[model samples]
Target: MPTLETLLLQLNSIKVIDDTIPYSQYIPLDLSISNLDLSQIDIKNPNDFEIYIETYLKKNNAKVAFGGYNEVRNLYKQSSLFGDGQVNERNIHIGMDLWIKAGTPVLAAIDGIVYGFDYNAGKGNYGPTIILKHNLENHFFYTLYGHLSIESIENIEIGSFFKKGQQLATLGDSTVNGGYSPHLHFQIIKNIEDHFSDYPGVCNQKDLKYYLKNCPDPDLLLKIK
Candidate 1:
């Protein structure tokens, strides 16, 4: 059996985001405090986060701010969903986040059937989420799209089929998207383990090894570089 990394390298044409913006338009943005200067701004607030994203994008002359997988961040500290106040904090993001404007159309990366959809409303939640199931080279896997607008899941049905590049959902604003800046949390799951429209997009240090393996780098499939 080929590893997920192997499969990703084999399948070289997969693209999760729209190709209208050339790959040069995408820039890497580090949310972690170690690299970015966040001394004056509150990283937890969505407005401030948005400002930071916009400022950084403009400074770098890029349209999309990409990269977040395995990044340890402070944005999840405000919510108990990430084990806030706990000894082992779930601050390590296990998926890639595409920092773009709200209402941006999210497209399907491959032909798949909608496994499920859910509205997980709360602070530091996935917000409107969708799960799609696909089979490639006899390997069954799932893709998760998070931080989507409420309308994204409106009238969405399970088992719905979508072709590659099909419009799947739209990015949600901070108010509805877990109080964070608008972005798409894209993840690939090798084994869902009964999870429906939701899965852990972040993990604690204690569970890093497990999640790092289960939710491999989305860039492998996105090929955004």
Candidate 2:
């Protein structure tokens, strides 16, 4: 039997955001603590971050900014949802993020059935999120699409089917997307366990090992590079 990672690598042409935009138009973005540029702007403010993204995209002459799998970031300080000031603060991002304008269509990475959907309200949360269960090589795994527009889940069915690259949702803005700039938080989960609709997209150093194992680098499936 092929491992989930191996099966993912064998697949081709996967995308989770705005298929109309080619991968060539996507540039890599670094939001980790090492990025000195973040010190110049207020990372807590969505508007400021949006402007930063705009400037970055324009600078690179690209439409999308992608990266952030297993990256340690400081932006979570704005919300207590990530355990602000806690000893084991969850600052490590365990998913890939595609930074784009609000309302950009969010697509399915592969053909799958909707496993769960919910509006994860509150700051530093997923806002509207969806989890899709997929079977490849007789192995079951899941894909999560977070920070989506409310309308995306309003009419979606629990067991609805979506083809690869099919539009599943649209990007949500700061007000409704857990107070962050518009982006699609895409994650791949090998063992979803009891999590439904919502899962931990960030983890503390202590649990980093487990999270990293369960949620492999989305690039294995996306191949955005």
Question: On residues 88-205, what C-alpha lDDT tens digit does candidate 2 reach at each position?
Answer: 9999999999999999999999999999999999999999999999999798999999999999999999999999989999999999999999999999998998888899999999
TM-score top scorer: 2
**Each prediction's Cα lDDT score?**
0.87, 0.94
* Candidate 1: stretches off by over 4 Å: none
Off by over 4 Å in 2: none
The residue pairs in collision within model 1 are none
lDDT of 1 by residue, 1-225 (tens): 987678877776665666577778899988774865876788878899899999999999998999888998887878988885477888999999999999888999788999988988899999999999989888888999999999999988889999988999999999898898999999999999989979999888899999988888888887887
Cα shift from native, residue 34, model 1 (Å): 1.0
Pairs in clash, predicted candidate 2: none
Lowest lDDT block of 10, candidate 2: 79-88
